[model samples]
Target: MPDPFSLSVIVPVWREAPGIESSLKALASIREAGHQVIVVDAGSDDGTAVLAGPLCDRVLVSERGRGAQMNAGAAAAGGNLLLFLHADTRLPADAVTQLETFMTSRSAWGRFDVRLSGRRALFRVIAWFMNQRSRLTGVCTGDQAMFVRRDAFEALGGFRAQPLMEDVEFSRRLCLVSRPYCIHSPVITDSRRWEKLGPWRTIFLMWRLRWRYWRGESPESLAQAYRSDVRNA
Candidate 1:
């Protein structure tokens, strides 16, 4: 008999060829344990799909956006549960066990705590605040590796068709169903963005963006501003 509580981990990528293989390889054990790993590429020219093909169960080509790519992955998944993972992030070793506990629970959705892949003390401080803020506000970021039951995901209609803050928007909607079942075991996410802008500058930029987003700014505008800032940084 098939496992009723199987998980499908979806990774959305765009030009992530440099680390795509390693990222998918990390999920090998999950695949071996009867879960599914789907990599959705948003029209990468760097052969990301080719590199990811053998490591995961399926490699899909989708529209050029994280939200669209993730939605495509969710649509193709065969598991009862769906996990939206980033290509630059790696789940903890005990993620399968943590997911099993979530599968047996009544939670509609969940996210893992996130730790930046930097050895600096400031990175730890940043991660601490991020976890605390998520716990307090019931809001989650993509770096956290969000997961939900496939039914709930389908009901919510997957991610919004936005370039940024899709995770925040989805989390707000998911909150209407149930508070996130946050696991303490942290997922390690790349800190290259922070490193690019310097930690404090990145934090302030993000806070400003979120504040504007909350003030009813459009995601397209926010994404443009983010790109400009990152380029200037």
Candidate 2:
């Protein structure tokens, strides 16, 4: 058993009106246990903050970017361990217990494997590849629900205020200090984006963006391209 520590789950959301309620509801057990839950809304007009306000310990309004919103949430968190969760991601029932145990014994920072919530067989393959790639590179994506020791996060200066690939950038910096735990238990994430964009197209675009990013392409340019592709898709 590892030393006990409180957890603060921070969820950065934008226009998540459709899923925010259910996501919060799913986290009821953790909240009931007196763990903190903070939802940072990115100026969503869809009542995202309103719905999330009563469910979470705190609701904050921030600039309309995932990275910015997440940093704001982390700034307001009270726990020693910070878990950054996606609005559409559903954590396992034992996530809180698992995290408490893992954090005490494992690396200072870690991420769970992701399971895409869809019936398509390709979704499984995509998740498998994603998990394997992350393991190989010691990099975890946002959808995988990354967590870190609060002191380490502050020392690393939180996440970079980039329009895209903030998780990638953060992971790169974090791995310089320690390798991620890479828990095998999975968090299920909604596959709406992949479904809407066509899985193959999304996969190709992601690979292209990652390749360009690795080659030193500007994040602003990559973000613009990504947004354009999403809109067109």
Candidate 3:
């Protein structure tokens, strides 16, 4: 059967073997109803590309960076919509259909949903905050599965190859063109990072960074400190 969505799912990955396989399995269950899932490998040392090769439509390699990987995948894609997903994030089953409907109805520039990856009460608050804040500010994270119309995506020149917050930057532009749909079903991201950091501390760091971003600091600088601190701990 011909795919109804004519959409492409782009997953940016780096050193994500453990969670990658599970995420792929979930994505595979989504079926090939007319969409292609491409895993953009950011030079993963964990052999994620090898494992994902047979599962996804295509596995692409790029320098070790999320922005670069996503840009590469978007350039190689042959679909009308480009959905940038994270390696550690799981999309809803009807993600493709919802994206297609939005694109078809309004020719949507781009949209993203809330993230639900943890069971903790604090995690729920943070996730809810992310959803609300993005709607108010036009800034979103990659874990949200940002989907954009092909032409609109190209016009933004894709995501910058920064080490962080490239999703927020691209989304800022997307918001100017159209209001994000904010899909009802949210994407669930792996909570390992936050859990490892201690939930409260992790949420604190996130809120601090977000506050800094609101105060005009570069998101990369804020995120750099947070992610480095996490990796170092």
Candidate 4:
């Protein structure tokens, strides 16, 4: 028999009030399906916590950083399976069932493919490349909705305290233990970032950052460059 386990969906948010309601509502089915949802807010003054309070199973406040917030959520979570999700991402209807099935296999870590939400054709190409590159490199991004067994996550020491590329670093460490189950069913994520910033420019910026990271660049410096680029874009 497969290892029976519960799931906890952890969402790390900072100033995401504009979209938090819809995102939490999207997880209603998952909550109803008996999984737990935890929203870790990084001191958002936009009522993100109040708005999410009624929707999710738990609402936590933490220091302002995605990695920190997610770590706090994971520490407080009681489920055997921990799913790190972004505020703007929505899982597919069958996500829980799929994860449950995959947990029966030898793989202990995984992420779903991602589809950017937009009508632009460029978004399709970006999504394709993102999924294919992740499959080839075994490095998953936060947008991909990374999931892991709680025991495995704890053993790996959770996400590193970094401002950027935490997902990539965590995936690298995870691959040391087991190859990730790259689920082909895609999760839908907001494309506003790409829409606000030029799609191709954003893609190139990400690629550049990844290359720099691979070359042993400091995350703080990369994070500063990323914020500056986004602000100036």
Clash statistics: count for each candidate: 0, 0, 1, 0
List ranges where model 2 is wrong by over 4 Å: 1-4
The C-alpha RMSD in Å for every predicted model, in order, reads 1.3, 1.5, 2.7, 1.0
Point out where model 1 deviates above 4 Å.
Answer: 1-3
- By summed lDDT, the worst window of 10 consecutive residues in model 1 runs over 1-10
| Per-residue C-alpha lDDT of model 4 across residues 1-233, encoded as one tens digit per residue | 64567999999998888889999999999889888999999998888999999999999999988889999999999888999999999999889889988788789899999999998998999999999988898999999999999989999899999999999999999999998997888999999999888898898899899999999999999999999999997
lDDT of 2 by residue, 1-233 (tens): 64458899999999999989999999999999989999999999999999988898999999988899999999999999999999999999879878877766648799999999999999999999999999999988999999999989999999999999999999999999899987788999999999999999999999999999999999999999999999998
For candidate 3, lDDT tens digit of each residue in 79-194?
Answer: 87888888778788777667767866664555556665778778888788878887787677877888887888888788887776678778777788877777878888778777
Q: Which pairs of residues clash in candidate 3, taking residues 3 or more apart in a chain or in different chains?
A: 3-34
lDDT of 2 at 122: 96
Provide the overall lDDT of each model, using Cα atoms, as 2-decimal numbers. 0.94, 0.93, 0.78, 0.93
Candidate 4 collision pairs:
none
Ten-residue segment with the worst summed lDDT in candidate 2?
Answer: 99-108
Question: For residue 139, what is the lDDT in candidate 2?
Answer: 87
lDDT-based ranking, best first? 1, 4, 2, 3
